[model samples]
Target: MKQSDQAVVFGKRKEPHTIIIARGSEIRHFTVRPWMAAFAGSAFAALAIGYLLATSYLVLRDDLIGAATARQARMQQAYEDRISALRSQVDRITSRQLLDQQLMETKVSELIERQSQLTKRHGRLGPLLDRAEAVVNGAKPAEGSAPAKPETRVELPSPAADTQLAYAAVGSAKNPFALWSTRNSAAQADSSADHADKLFVTLNQSLRTIESEQLARIDSLAENAYQTADVISDALESAGLPVDADFGKADVGGPLIAVDNPSMFDTKVKELDEALDKLDKVKKEAQRLPLANPAPGRSISSTFGVRRDPLLGTPALHSGMDFRAPMGSDARATAAGIVVKAGWNGGYGRMVEVDHGSGFSTRYAHLSRIDVREGQKIATGDTIGEVGTSGRSTGPHLHYEVRRNGEAVDPLRFLKLGKKVGQYL
Candidate 1:
C-alpha cells in the first residue's frame, strides 16, 4: 500500500499536525505551487464563464425565434385584413352591377314605347300618301263593283308604367301597352328587315309602275302627234302643198293658198296650226290653266249689272260675278296667285284677295272656311276657301271679282278664256 501526503482531520486533535506515510518499495510525491492557486481559480472562473456563455447563446436564440414567430403572425394578420378589404370591394362592385342592370331594363322599356308610336304613325301616313298619289296619277284601274267605305276611326296605343315591369324580364312586362310595344318592336325589327327585303321588291314594283305610266303617257302623246301629223300631211296634199314634210321646212304662201281665196280657209288653217304649236309648247312646259272647272260649277247667282236690293228698294251696281254653291263646298282659286288678304271685309265676309301676276287680281267673298292664309302662293284649281252665305249675301254663294290694273273688270271675258283651256290644269 502507498501512503499519500494528505492531512487527515481528527475530531479530538489539540495541535496542528503533519502526517507522513512511507511505502516499502516506491515513493509518490505531490507538490502544490503557490501560483497554482491562481491557475485553479482562473480555470474554475473560465469554466463558469463558458457555461454562462452557452446558456446565454441558447436563451438569445430562443428569444430571436419567438420574436420571428410573433412578427410572422403580425404580417399574416395584416394580409388577412387586406384580403378582407378586397373581398368587401368585390361585394360592392357586384351590387353596383345589379343596380346597373335595373337601370338598363328601364331604358329599354322607354325605347320600346317610342318605337310603337312611330310604327303607328308610319302606317297611317304610308296609306294616305299612297291614296293621294293614286288619285293624282289617275293610274288605278276602274273597279267592277262599288267600293265599301273604310271605317275612319283610328286608335293609338299608349305607354307603360315603371311599377308594371319591375319584376318581369326585359320583354315580359304585364302592361298591355308595354307588351304591345315589345311585340311591336320585335315585329318592327322583323318588319324592317322584311321591309328592307320588300323595299327592293317594292322598289322594283314601283319602278315598273312608274315606267308603265310614263310609257303610257308617251304612247298617248305619240299617237296624238301621229294623228295630227297625218291629218296635216293629208290636208297639205289635198291643198297641193308640200306633203310628208317637216313643219320646219314648209312654205305656205306661194301657190298653195293662191292670192284669191274667197273662203279664207287656208289662212284660218294656218292660224289654227300656229295656235296648236303654241299649245304644244305650253303642254311641254307643264303650264297650268286658270282652273279645273273653268266656268265655276256654281250657279250664276248674280251678273255684272245694276240690280235692286232685296232688303232695301234701292238700286245697286254689281261690279263682279257671283256664283251660288252649297255651303262649305270647296271654292277653288280662279288662277295661280299669291293670297294678299284673308280676312273679313265690310260687305263681304271672310274675303280672300289674290294678286295674280300680269297686273291681274281677284277677290273671293262669303266664305265659311278660309283654307289659304295671307301671303300664301296658291296654284290654279287649289282650294282657297269653303263657300257660305256670309255678310250681305242672299244665300250660300261665292262673290268673285276680277280687277286689271286695279280697275274693276268684267269677269265673263276671263271665264270664256278659261273655258278654252283643257280640263286638267
Candidate 2:
C-alpha cells in the first residue's frame, strides 16, 4: 500500500488504522472492523422484536374477546333464571288472591241467605204466640179468625233454566307478563275473583230457595195444625168444655179491631195451630219409630218395690219389675224411645236402656244377646234383647225398669198408662 495517497475501498474486508503521534516518535496499529455484520445483527434483532410484539398483541386480543363472550353468556343465563322465578311467584300470588276473594264472597252470600230465612221464621212467630195465648185464656175461637172467604189457590210454575246459565263461561287466555310489562297480567287472579263471585251468588240462590221451601213446609204444617185444632175445639164443645161467651166480640168499637194490638183474636188461633202442629209432629215421630215386637205376651215374674236381692241375699229396693223368661227369649220395649245404652251394666249385665221423650226411660237387663244399639229408636213392643242370666242374676229373666228424669218410678204406673193410651197409639 502507498503511504501518502488516500485509498478508497468498496465492499471489501478492511482493517481500521490507529495512529499515535508523539513528540519524539510516531506509532501506527491496524485492526479488522465488522461494521456490516454488526448492522445486519441489529436489523435482525429489531425485526424479531417487532414480530414478538405483534404475536403478543394478537393473543391478548383473542383472550379479551373470549372472556367478554363468556361473561355475556353467563349474564344472559342469570337473567333468564330470574325472570322464570318471578313469573312463577306472580302466578302463585294471583291464584291465592283469587281463592280468597271467592271464599269471602261465598261466606257473605250464605250469611245473607241465612238472615233472610231467619227473618221469615220470625215473621210467623208473632201471630202464633197471640193465638196460643187466647186459647189458653178459656176463650172460644173468635169470628173472622178463620177465613170465611173462599181459599185462594196459586199454581206453581215448573222450574226454568236460563240460557246464560246453561252455557259454560269461556275462561280468559294466558299471556306472558314480559310481553306487556306495564300492563297487569294476572289472568288467573281476575278469573278466580269472577268464579268466586259466581259461586257465592249460586250458594246464596240455593240458600234462598231452601228458605222458601222450608217456609212452604211450615205453612203446610200450620194449616194442618189449624184444621186439627178446629176439630178438637168442636169436639171439646160437643163434650161440653167451658168457653168464654165474649170470645168472638171485638173489645172496643163493636167488632172494630184495635191498631198494634199484638194480641189479635186470630193471633191466638195461629199460636194454637202451631202448638198443635208441633205436638202432632212429635206423635208422628213416635209412631214412625221401629217396633221391636208385634205381640206383647211377656209374663211378669216380680213386682217393682222393696225385695231381697236374688244373688246377694240382702234386702234391697227393687227399682224395677222382673219377667221370668226362657234363655234367649226376646226382651221387648214397653214404649217408643231411643236406645240410650246397649251393653253390660254393673249389676244388670247385658242391659239395654231406652229414653223416651219428656224424661221417661226404660231398662231391660239380664240378656243373653243385645239386639238394639245406642241411639236406635224403637216403638212399643219392640224387641230390644234376648233374655238370659247375665250379671247378679240367678236365672234367665228380664229386669224391666221405668225412670222419670233419672229417678226411679213405679213401673206399674207406666204400664197402666200404656194401657190407657194404647188405643190412641
Candidate 3:
C-alpha cells in the first residue's frame, strides 16, 4: 500500500516488469520484481490473435474447396455428353453401311438365278425346235441355230455373306463397319450397291429378249400342230372313218390374276400340249382304219365283186381280192386289230378275221397254214397266216377283204388312200 509502489505498478512503462508473490500466515516476504506479469500479458495477447487467424483460415478454406469441386463436376458432365453424341453418330453410320451391303447381295443373287433358269430353258428347247423345224419345213434344223445354245452365260457375281453389320465392303472385309473404322467404309458400301444395279439392268435386258424369242417359237409350234390336226381330221372324214380327236378335254387350269408382266411360258406350253394331243388323236384315228395294203408286192390275181371263181369254175360274187403269192408266204394284217376268227373255215382254208375298233374289221382267207390265234392282238403289217392252195383256193394266193359293220368294202379304196399319205399318219 505504499504510494511509490502503487505508482510503479500502475504506470505505463516500455520495459517488461517482474513481480513476486506472498502468502498469509507463513509471514514470508520477498522482492516485488521476481514474477513477470507484463510478459504473461504479452503472451496472452499473442495467443488471442493466433486463435482469430486460425478460425478465419478454416472458414475460407472450406468455401474455396466447395467452389473447386462444383467446377470440376460441371466439366466432367460436359465431357460425358460429348462422348454420348459421338457414339450415336457411329451407330447410324454402321447401320447405313450394313443396309447397302445387304441390298447389293440380294439383287446379285436374284440376277444369277434368273440367268440360270433361262439357260436351262434354252437347253430344253433346242432339240424340240429342231424336230419342229424338220416336221414343218420338211428339212433338218440348222446346227447351233435351234435355241442357239445361248452363247456362254453371263458371269455370276459372288456376293454370299458379303453384307454384315460387323463386316466391311463387298470384295474385302478388312475395314469394319463401326465407329472406330478409320476407312471410308460407308462410301465403299454405296459403290457396291451401284455396281449391282448396273448388273440388274444388263441382265433384265437379256432376259426380256430371250423371253420374246421363246414365246414366238412356242406360238409357231402350236400353230403347226393345230394345222396338222385339222388336215388329218378332214382326210379321215373323207375316208368314212370316225374322227375322235378332242383337244380341250385335257384338265388345264390354275389361279388367274391380272398382272403387268404376265409369264407367257406356261400359257404357251399348255397350248402346245393341247395342239399335240389333237394331232396325235387324229393321226391315230386314221391309222386305226383298215387302209393299208394287206399283201404288199403281190400281184392281184382276182378282182372283187362279180368274178369267175378258179376252184368253182363258175361266175359268182367275190367278197375279196386275190393276191398271187408263193407257197408259205406271209399273209399280213393291213390294220391293227384283235383276231376274232382264226384257223380253218368251210370256204377259207386258214382264215383270220381281225376286229378293228369303230365297227371296222379285216379278213385274210385261203391260207395254207394258220399262224394267228383267236383273241390275239395284232399290228399293221403283222403276219396272220401263210398263203397256199387250200379250201376254195386256186393256187398259192391270199384273199384280203375289208368290212365295215359286217358289210364288205372294196379293199382297193383303202389301199389307195393309205399309200398316198401313209407318211403323215
Which TM-score value belongs to model 3? Answer: 0.56
Q: In model 3, where do residues sit more than 4 Å from their true spots?
A: 1-103, 112-199, 209-217, 245-263, 311-315
Clashing pairs in 3: 18-33, 19-35
- List, residue by residue over 23-46, the lDDT tens digit for candidate 2: 556565444357766887999999
- Report the Cα lDDT for candidate 3: 0.68
Which has the greatest lDDT?
3
| TM-score to native of every candidate shown | 0.35, 0.35, 0.56
Off by over 4 Å in 1: 1-277, 280-296, 423-425
Q: For model 2, what is the C-alpha lDDT against the true structure?
A: 0.59
Model 1 scores a TM of 0.35
Ranking by TM-score: 3, 1, 2
